[model samples]
Target: MKKVFLLILVISTLAVASQLEIFSSSGEWAFFENPARLLSMNKQGVMGSYQVFSGEGESLGTFLVGLFQTPAPNIAGVLYLKRSTLTESSYRTTIEYDAAFSPEESLNVGAGVSFTMDQEERKEIDLHGGVSGYLFKDVGFGVSVRDFTLWSQKGTYMGGTYLLKLFYDSSRKNRFSYSLVFDQEVLENRIDFTIGSEQKAGLGVSVLSNTKTKENTVKISLGFYATVNNVSVGFGTFIISSPVSSDPFSEYYYTQGTGIKFAVRW
Candidate 1:
């Protein structure tokens, strides 16, 4: 059988609480980090954003709604609601929060947490705690370990997911901008990797794939985002080849979708 464990498969139903952010306050963060960020907006004020996404991959359909605030001159507050229900698994929901503080002219630090339903059988990896920071020259980085506590229930063997992201681009007007990202497993023998770029007027793409051979596969990502009079919207898609696992007729597939996001200052 193919270990097509497309982990982030629960895109349809999850119960989660979240916060809406005003990240597009500045045209500098236009793409919402999705490459589709060509959107425009305010620079030094508060802003709120909400995004709804849905698509299909190796598993059933996945859909999600995101609300958050972008980093500004002061501390940033955020919330996220994520629900995953696919295969034979029950509906799983996750609630998360992010608070950031700026102590220097060009540096920042923050922490976060996610609460979710517990599975006894998947003990030792349910609760997650994470931290993030920013560097100099418009470059920033974030890392979080989900399910750090590893709380398990029933026979699900529930574990947490880890995420890491990096972004860097200039704020020059009418100029080309670019960005990149990386994601991997927290404590298992699995890893997912991707790297891509974007532009100012709204144009970009990226490649996503796995490191291990049996699971070796590749997908290209395309995205764009823009704003008009405090309203921002974004769209993205990923295309990949069929399954490479044994029994190629195992109903293999990939993913592609369009997303819309809106934000305004408080």
Candidate 2:
């Protein structure tokens, strides 16, 4: 019982931490993360993703669906719905709308709004915005502000989350990116690193590290994605290692959990 409780606690903490940072570098989900990336899409498509995390008899599941389109040459938009289940009777749903505008070839700006409702009917509204542009032909920088509380029926007005990102693309085929994220309410800092290819079938990996605590928590994710005939599919898995405790006679103990994801876009 103690082990199970500990596992649940760790997983829950990790889940909340994950929500505080931008994880996607680029893709259909990147718009959901940073909004400015909406302009990066070249075609209209719908995407769906499902993910589950499990450890020590406790599990959490999330489902997301997104629709993206470019109605004009310089504008792109996306709408997405995300639902997560913490327990059989406990769940939360979020719906968001985001749009990006590129006035020039090298500059993009975006804004978004979202509403979230939990099982208890508690509702919250959040605002998001971002700017991204190329510094050189193959290097870019981005800044985003997320989770700015517009209103909350039962929650306090926490300040917004901020992220600064830098990325380099070689021939627009492969990318390496890094982001520094700050959560104002929690006073926490996290760093994310990712490397991947955007063409054909490719493998990618991402690492996230919490820099606020001495015993940092690290999450590593690996995935493979392929595109064919305007359809894309992805398979991914992630492992999280969190420091649990330290004993007088032994080194620090760590707890680990794993999760899997499946996503498709067409």
Looking at candidate 2, what is the lDDT of residue 262? 25
- Give the TM-scores of the predictions, in the order they appear: 0.53, 0.75
Candidate 1 lDDT by residue in tens digits, 1-266: 11122111112112221111122213433322221122122232322222222234324333344444545545555555555444445445666554555565444455555566522223222443334334655555544444444444454443334545554544323222222222231111212221222221233333333434435444444445555543444444444443332211111233332333333332
lDDT of 2: 0.62
For residues 1-266, what per-residue lDDT tens digits would candidate 2 score against the true structure?
Answer: 65455334434443433211123545666765578888877777666666565544445666676778888889999888888776455777899899999978999999999999988999999999999989999998889998799999866775777888787777666666666665542222334343445432323333333334434555555555555545555555555564323311111122332232222333
The whole-model C-alpha lDDT of candidate 1 against the native structure comes to 0.36
Instruction: Report clash pairs, candidate 2.
Output: none
- lDDT: which candidate is best? 2
Clashes of each: 42, 0
Please give the distance, in angstroms, between residue 147's alpha carbon in candidate 1 and its true position after superposition: 5.8
- lDDT at residue 150 of model 2 (Cα atoms): 98
TM-score of 1: 0.53
